[model samples]
Structures are given as C-alpha cells and as structure tokens.
Target: MGRSKLDVGEIYMAESKIDARIYSEEEYLALDSDLDVKYEYFDGRVIAMAGAARKHVSITGQAVTALNNQLRDTPCEAGSSDLRVQLEGTRNYLYPDVVVWCEESRWADKADNTLLTPLVLIEVLSASTGHRDGSYKLEIYKQISGLMDYLIVSQNRVYIE
Candidate 1:
C-alpha cells in the first residue's frame, strides 16, 4: 500500500499515521552512525522537524543548564540534545532538547549512548515542530515509565506546555 500524503499542518481524521516501511533495529542504529544531523523514526519512516533556531537554542540551553546544576551530586544527570532514546522495538528514537535521568552510575562511559529515562523532559519549541512536539512526541514520551514531568518551552512569549 502507498503512504498517505499529508502536509505539515494538515490534520488527518486519524491521530496517527502508519508508515509502510518498518525499520529493523540495525537500520536505526546505522542511521545514528552518520555524521550529519540524524532524525528519529517510528516504524520505518523518518519523522521530520526543522533545525533549532536561535531562540529555541537559547531557551534549551537555559533549561538544560539550570536542570544540570540542580541535578549535580544527585544520581540524575541532565543532558541537552545529546542523547537519544529508543522507544520499545518500534524504532522510535528521539533526542529531546533536555532530559534528566537518575541512573548515571549504570552507564560505563559518559557518552556510551545511554537511553536515559528522564524524570524531567524539556523541549524548546519551534513553530515548525510545535505540533509534533506537543502531540506525537508528547505521546511517545508519555509511554516512558519513568517520566514524571514533561515541559514544552515556547520560544515565543514565555509559555510552557
């Protein structure tokens, strides 16, 4: 079957879009090996979102820095957009703008590709990706058993979702 054509903001009658291709774990891992900015996937198809803008990055940095300072000396570690999470076997891996995970001692190395289960997750929203972050990504992160607080920080006037 062919994939449905849906524009970025066009809302489908259905909430979720099922892709025709289902990627294996190997394929997902290989995609991460590339040097360019990689993307996350659900099933087999890539999920598209624009690169972070200046305001977006600023907000992200502020949030991460604050969270990192707060988490210091605790078991939790705060990370900015430097970690990826593999959700189940659905090939859904996302790099949330800011994440805080409490299991720091488990990972042997700092950059050992750990999929930390954040008790706190933050995303500095961009207009192009706000909907996806609020909806699709929101749902995906909710599936994480350890998530306690999820914040979607707006680059526009001070707002958080």
Candidate 2:
C-alpha cells in the first residue's frame, strides 16, 4: 500500500490536527522506507516528525555522551535518537531523544532496531513539542515497566526533569 499524505500543519508541532484518516499499523510501517522522514504511530494515526533544531540536536548529543560515560563499565548503554522503542504489545512506536537500557535488550523485530525495553528515556523538548512531551508522550513513556527516569530537557533553557 502507498503511504497516505495528509495536508496537516507545518509538521513541526507535536500534536497535529490530522483529520483526513486513521491509518493502520501496517500502513504506517510500509512508509518506513523513506529514510529522510520519521513518523510516530499513535494507536491508528501516524504523525510526521519534523527535523530537530540546532540546540535540540546539540543537547541530545551531549546527553548521550554524558550518559554513555556515566554508564561505562556497567550493564546499561546509551542509544541515539534513531532507536525506535515499542510500547510492549501496544501499537505505539516512538523515537526518544536518548535512551538507556540496563537489562537484556529485547528487539521488537528481527533486525534489532526496535526496542521493547529501556531503563531510561530522555526527550529534549522544542518550542513546538513542549506540550506533547509533557502530556501525551509523558503518559505513554510511563507505561514502560523498566523506565526509571524520564527526563524532559528544555533545549532553550537549563531546566530538566
């Protein structure tokens, strides 16, 4: 099946007004071949992800580096934003800014790119995504059984939680 294109907003907002149609998980996965674009699956709706800003990218990189260094010689390891995390048996798939897995890694697929378990997930918030990160994404990430820390860092400020 071909990917569905909807004329949503600028695609930079976290919560977009996609009223065209709700797509199935299979249809959403079929569009994954487009390397330049990323999509987040929420129930039956697919939301297009926008490219990160300069400060957001820098903060994510620094967090990954610092987390890796802090987790060195331990069981946990840091993964970049490309890592896809599944919400266990649910139909949700998201890309966190930085992730740390301490126990055995569980791959959602055979390719080992999708993760099913992670100990810590960090999201570097942007102006357009702050609300979603604090609300929708927060509720979803909390469903993870092994998640101990969920830090939402502000890219333009020094606040984090």
What is candidate 2's lDDT per residue for 1-161, written digit by digit as tens? 32122322223233574435667878877875477888877776777778898888989999999999999999889987888888998888888989998758787788777889888999999886777777667777888887888999987677997
Tens digits of lDDT, candidate 1, 1-161: 32222332133113334334556767766766665756666655654334778878888888878887887888777787767765553456777888777763233226657474557788877766676678767777777766789898888777887
Clash pairs for candidate 1: none
Deviation from native of the Cα of residue 57 in model 1, angstroms? 0.9
How many clashing residue pairs are found in candidate 2?
0
Candidate 2 lDDT (Cα, 0 to 1): 0.78
Among these predicted structures, which one has the highest lDDT?
2
Cα RMSD of all models vs. native, in order, equals 5.8, 6.5
Which pairs, if any, clash in model 2?
Answer: none
